[model samples]
Target chain A: MGQRPGDLSAPARLAGPDEGIGADELALATRNHGLPLEALRHDVTPPGLHYVLTHYDIPYVPDAGAWRLTVDGHVRTPLDLSLADLLSFPQVTTRVTLECAGNGRALLTPRPVSQPWLVEAVGTADWTGVPLRRLLAEAGADPAAVDVVFTGADHGVERGVEQDYQRALPLSVATGDDPQVLVATAMNGAPLPPQHGRPLRLIVPGWYGMAQVKWLRSVTVGDVPFTGFQQSVAYRIRRTPDEEGEPVTRIAPRALLVPPGFPDFMSRTRVVRPGPVRLSGRAWSGQAPVSSVEVSTDGGAHWEPAVLDPVVDGHRWAWRAWHHTWTATPGEHAVGTRASDADGHVQPLDQHWNRGGLANNAVCFVRVVCVADACWP
Target chain B: MGQRPGDLSAPARLAGPDEGIGADELALATRNHGLPLEALRHDVTPPGLHYVLTHYDIPYVPDAGAWRLTVDGHVRTPLDLSLADLLSFPQVTTRVTLECAGNGRALLTPRPVSQPWLVEAVGTADWTGVPLRRLLAEAGADPAAVDVVFTGADHGVERGVEQDYQRALPLSVATGDDPQVLVATAMNGAPLPPQHGRPLRLIVPGWYGMAQVKWLRSVTVGDVPFTGFQQSVAYRIRRTPDEEGEPVTRIAPRALLVPPGFPDFMSRTRVVRPGPVRLSGRAWSGQAPVSSVEVSTDGGAHWEPAVLDPVVDGHRWAWRAWHHTWTATPGEHAVGTRASDADGHVQPLDQHWNRGGLANNAVCFVRVVCVADACWP
Candidate 1:
């Protein structure tokens, strides 16, 4: 719903190629592409509207003197390669979307404190690069070592706590193939941008942006976790704020905390002729791939099945477009979409707010203005 | 473990911050601050070093522009001011840790695919900043709007795909004392460096790095969410990569995926006259705060409570450091930490893996070197 013939009233600004969230721009309405409607505006998230995260730091704008991916940690052949060297590895390409775990925070209830996201945290693109697994294989990392630390170019301190923006991933996640994660140098068919990790970045199709460490640096394989400031105690949750006295673990998986429908704006219009209307939208899974998408015309009582679009198998990152048609006789109507993942998990309806905006996967909903079928009266 | 006279060789020459992981420096060692005698060493993660995540996109170089704090989400009146403005309000600080969601990946059986991060994904720090909840009151956002979106200046559009660094917070979280989210413009005592968010950056005491958007831009208040790709579909699970139709909806809370004990390389150097050797470490929560931390010395056998370090009540973002001594008889011991939050949620031993490394909270382990006092003969 971004553009309508005469809707020049809406801002028609194009995000500069390099400009991310401009320092001066005020956040108004925003959403992550990976999030659902109630949580995010699905269709209208423009290209200049994606989200990003770095493991250690932001795009290094690496000094030409030092631009390499060093393979250290517990490995047989400690290796380091220049950007040019990465090019020599067999390149791989896949269309993937990187999202931040906290992407859909805008809609969560209980009201947690977090980022002021302008819709567009999720971004899907054809990523071309070297498979990190391929590199691990070539480097001959110790199979016993399970963690892989991905350092970024961004740097700084967080209090007396000198810290890095680095994060770690499991060997399994590092080598899976739903989309086959990779150290991407190309996105959507172009070279990476300074804001998007120019020389190299990780393209982890179905993860929160943090997993797709923006600026790539060294990949350390180790026998034990490095416990860097970022990996040891951050990004966690327990049952409640009062629950943890010693150390707490993490938040449990919850359904997309949407109202029931998504991208309602796309279905919006001052005028709507009712007849056989095909309601269409997209549904996806964060905890697992979605199996079915349910739609409700009436508030929440009965639900009708909607056809799901085809997506690459097990590609949890890509979303499935869904559609359902309804006979018309309209006044006002409510529509909602609920996704059920392969794990029998369905988008939930509500979530009590906690301190950190951890996991809020509630059902999504929206109100619609319907009109009677046009006819000669 | 790093320095011991009349025993191990003198500490290896300290590698310059810019130096790559080399031989002597290959095995990283750190004497965890609070813990004594029981030091551990790994091939990565040097003490005095950890990953960092800054909020601003611009480098933190001494510059001209003054920094300000903006509070507009769901408030009655939107407020924007500079670093001076934030400082004028009030100042507060807390010790906290920020770990990447997928810190222990190599340990996952079947080896999940993604960045093979072995070590160095955790860190701790004392943070100082103005409480955000108070600012929201100052801004006067509508009470009905329960969500606030935070945008950042670091923007990137690659191959028609645009990604921004942003996040959203629930009203409860934004205005709370515990978790006590901060609009931080400084680290330790110094002004935030350009590498970090110079003028300002948010310090969400608890939660994954994904929620901590760097290069923050603006904040918006709304009754419902404006979904972006990141909010809905990413950071989810796709149970069983083999089968897929629609992806799952829920966003699992981020947690530490503790790996099996590092029983290898590390041997018990003490424990000759085993008595009560205090075991201490840190644990944190994401959505909710931690209630208690328990330690398991015999795999999942019996559990004992650890003395929790001081942590502010209602603070979900901050972690509770803990200590508990255990008497041992030499050989090898598996020490693990598991915690529960206010919601009664506890950490598990395993978690499902996805292509993208998202919320991976599993009870983690700690291996100790307990040698029988060198078999003093």
Candidate 2:
């Protein structure tokens, strides 16, 4: 059953430092998970290791063979395609990095009581699918259409508004050649896993994860801007409830290091050996390719340029690897990293706060204590 | 560097309701995740959707082909085998259900501040591998051995003690014919995923998740009991920290329903239509095959029998499906479910309190509100 607008829970509130995450928030965190920072070692994260944030129940699509994708609305000709029909189209594989808009939401001073994600809310995947432009061209799209809305089978209520989990993309981006969007059918050379949208899903390269509508069912072209609940209400950067905030779209530049050495089970404080250590991590941005990455051994107080790996062809949307070698001394220290995109967009030392805690691309710092080998068993 | 016994964090403490989950706890929850309750609909949960609780980082197993498994200690002949060696053995695949000892820990009165899992810390998977008995026999296992300690490559510090992650099983269980344990190399018919110990892992049927060691490296047959931190200190049932609590082993009898209807984003409250709703869920127990399941519609004030699906051969370790149909009227109601095993171990209505909060299998309740169709947008 659909939920009524009046059948709402308490309005979203920021939790103070002393305020514990409520049972409701804990429930969300338990089901949705972030990629462990150490998983950064893999160029293409295994499907199971990739981050996931499902807003609703993973719909049970028992028979994918019978699933169909419908394309209509503001089009010269409507088209209905089955899984087999979609498979018949020419396929393209793209390695793309997808990051949640609220990746560092948990680091905020008074954090938005939502997923409470840390820097781990990101992953790179090999997505294979039919380009949206090809599907739209075959369907005879109308040039007058301003936006295209994608709908997923998963449904739920958000802020008291019941929706079919719809999100709209500007027609330009939907049909553009630079960063082509796709009706993704496979991930990492295999059919999409259930949590990644088993039967079908939309893959918008370089865009934040929210734009990649999953468990896709239909595509609708519209003349006017499609202002659905997901597009107009949620995923926005607002300072106040009544403000018409800027929309959160592309991922901001960010760099996260694969924590060096072993971890303490409780505090996750890293313990390292005193010697030459090679610190490495991945950096990326949606606005442009990451051109430079900086390492800070004393947190953000000091910085040094790190060597960047050559960007490979056909993987511009994926993260670029960077590494630095540091001669360590035995003591407690903080290590940090940041990135700058080709467009000159740099990660801020401290993130700007917003009511919804969206697009937090702040520098990441890891606390480490270097000691002698004899300290352990 | 390994952590010293003196470099410890504060001892584990149970959190009162008002006290918030510590940042350390949130850090752990973000990296580890539980299975979504709705995923129970699938008989074999997809590997990606399966529950994962890694104590340390998912070690970078760069090349599974080059990985080796060593069987030594107390064996008549030490055996060093490569991945190909393990794969060449007689292969066996079994569907087994695994539940965490801390499944319902968060629901306790004063909860242990760990992963904070609710009722979702469980999943079933088809594990393919070589039988442990076959491997032990090939290595010439010593019949006088009392325990078999399995070691994983992933290493970190727990309770200030630095060591490789390890767990031990009784000699009989390791080489038994009834509930065969496996040196699993694959999951769900494919090579084991990275998070699931890409190279190798141990799968002990009918035991709690703690007994399943991922990222396996070596096996040591020993005459003395294994006293690792994970085996003796953690995963125990105790009244106080000083008590030598009983070791947690098998899964308790429990049932969890696929929460019906749609969920509200903030509170996860369920909304349903006024009609006949087919309530369904999965139930299981490690002690024995699930013999019965019951459904309660009024906060568990009363319960009625639910039909159980017949168990299939070769998959006796998996959960059994159960279903019940409820004709509903428009109003708010609490729906609950409970299960009993063949050994007469029934899920408790209220779980008993403990220091570590392990093996709690209390009834699960989902609050749902029934409304008319017009109530939705």
Candidate 3:
């Protein structure tokens, strides 16, 4: 409320490093949402159940069929493609997992003051789209292009920088076949929902959600590394605001429990009857396929290996299911899970803090109580 | 971190009346979302854009095909129907606007420490299912039945009481022909999304969301009113902790603006250029159809009527679109909107206080700036 309209370059209000979440952060949290742990029980997150984080308003695309995508910049032949034109191309559907780079930001001490995600910012979806390489090949990208900048229709100001939502991928990643990048037009066999970027969006497999630009409108074959605000200013893992830190990409290995039993309405703390309870959850990694998962019934003091579901044929980029059977006693306990990928990147037992709190894939912990049978409904 | 699991009756941590939102409240906000103001532009909110608030975890129905709805208790003929059986009945679709009883709870002074909703907890959807009266008629309700209790598969503890999520409607309301209630199986044009009660749910038009139980499992006809925890403890308009107050029901007449321009990332404040701007939004009421919507650009000092879209042949329960054109000069302004219903219910200029913060339909206010053209994006 104290902001001056003329102060165009001023940073808006944020929660103090040591203070509780401010109204502004709560406002953002209410607008965007994190996946509920219970929803992890589903193999493919259903519509509306998937976690959503939009930096700007979901732009109103009055007529999606009329929307066009332009491929220009360093391309040898600039091309304009309509929805029907893109749909005519050979379509491929891939099951991929997407996670917010700031999944555990709020859990960090001196928490980064945006979104406030807490380990629930991940979901798997079957995205159907035309391969980006096919589009780039048709447009004849210039050999010297270094990055493919994707621009979305959503526009807003972030960190005092006003611009359209844009993100860029290295040219090699965009054209590679290992994990195909796609210009997605459908999700889960249905036309894209408005919030998930209806009309068109980019789906960068194995990368953090920032690489998947929604409401995509323009794709530029750039000769230089794209240095937009989102590309450089935000989504960076830094120790301080002044230094330009590493750009955040790829989902870090993480496992989350499905939160066994029912949750208290206000606290969301789990209450289960003392018995042999099956603990299950999903684990995924963008850097590499998840190789193993470990479970701890008594916090991080001791750990045991959990059974990992065999990798499916075509879902190498989707999450792997894992489970552990625990004979719970009647008492309070902290349950935790950690996932490690084939690349040997293990979740840290404790959090490593960064200025932006990007990619804090620490061990996921859930506080629960195993109540006596008589007390449970 | 301070709670004792064994002390079942103790209230969980709550933010003091004057304190900022606690982490627990923020956690709730991230799990549930309010409809973004821009979404009002859609006549029928797309999948995932609709507001959702699940009291407990979204119950996992392993096989929705095998799920059954039982009508028992005082009914003349207890009936158990499968998903297929319910689908064979005559289906009716209704476009209804459902609002949480606690829509503007967060705006109240000494705010209620619950979901912390601020105006966005409302959405309009086309719900398709069989009418509840048809089912009741088939089951042959007892003549002396006074209430119809709905029980959902979701079970959880609240205020130390454990039970399945349940709510009841007076028999008259459930059987009345006006604004027929439906046992909805599809939302929009697709099967119910998980977060929106997959398999089946009850949709009572013109009532608050609590009466429309999701993940529905049973209906009980009773000679006495149902006294479940959700009915007696929560969702009440209590003046003091000990007072019963009135039972919360029906959406209050309210109007919200589709925030005109781009928003700042952290604060979500709007900024616009110095020129003519068209403003549009939606208004609705539960007690009666929305009759008028008024707009105020000078912080409620003066008001002007907005043009309301003509009512369609159907969709009597859906929201009415309203718009106003304003000539802007460079300065800060607080824009407000207020709606009145045909029943003579007008939204208050200031919020009314209550213990549970239920049914607070105060005027909606949005802060914005008509910045000089030079500073605009």
Enumerate the candidates' DockQ scores in order: 0.01, 0.61, 0.55
**Model 3 lDDT vs. the true structure?**
0.87
**In every candidate, what fraction of the native interface contacts is reproduced?**
0.00, 0.69, 0.58
What i-RMS does each candidate reach, in Å? Answer: 29.5, 3.0, 3.9
| Residue pairs of candidate 2 with colliding backbone atoms | A20-B20, A272-B1, A273-B1
Global Cα RMSD, each model = 23.8, 1.7, 2.1
Best model per TM-score: 2
lDDT by residue for model 2 over B244-273, one digit each (tens)? 999998888899999999888778888788
- Looking at model 2, residue A325 earns an lDDT score of 97
- Candidate 2's C-alpha runs over 4 A off are A1-5, A374-377, B1-5
Which digits, one per residue and each the tens of the lDDT, describe model 2 over residues A107-196? 888889888888899999999999999999998889889999999999887777777899999989999987999999999999998999
Per-residue lDDT value at A114 in model 3: 82
Q: Any runs in candidate 3 off by more than 4 Å, and if so which?
A: A1-18, A375-377, B1-14
TM-score of each: 0.42, 0.98, 0.97
DockQ of predicted model 3: 0.55
**How do all the candidates rank in terms of TM-score, highest first?**
2, 3, 1
lDDT of 1 at A26: 11
On DockQ, the leading prediction is 2
Q: Show where candidate 1 strays beyond 4 Å.
A: A1-46, A53-66, A117-120, A157-160, A176-179, A242-271, A286-288, A312-317, A327-330, A352-354, A371-377, B1-377
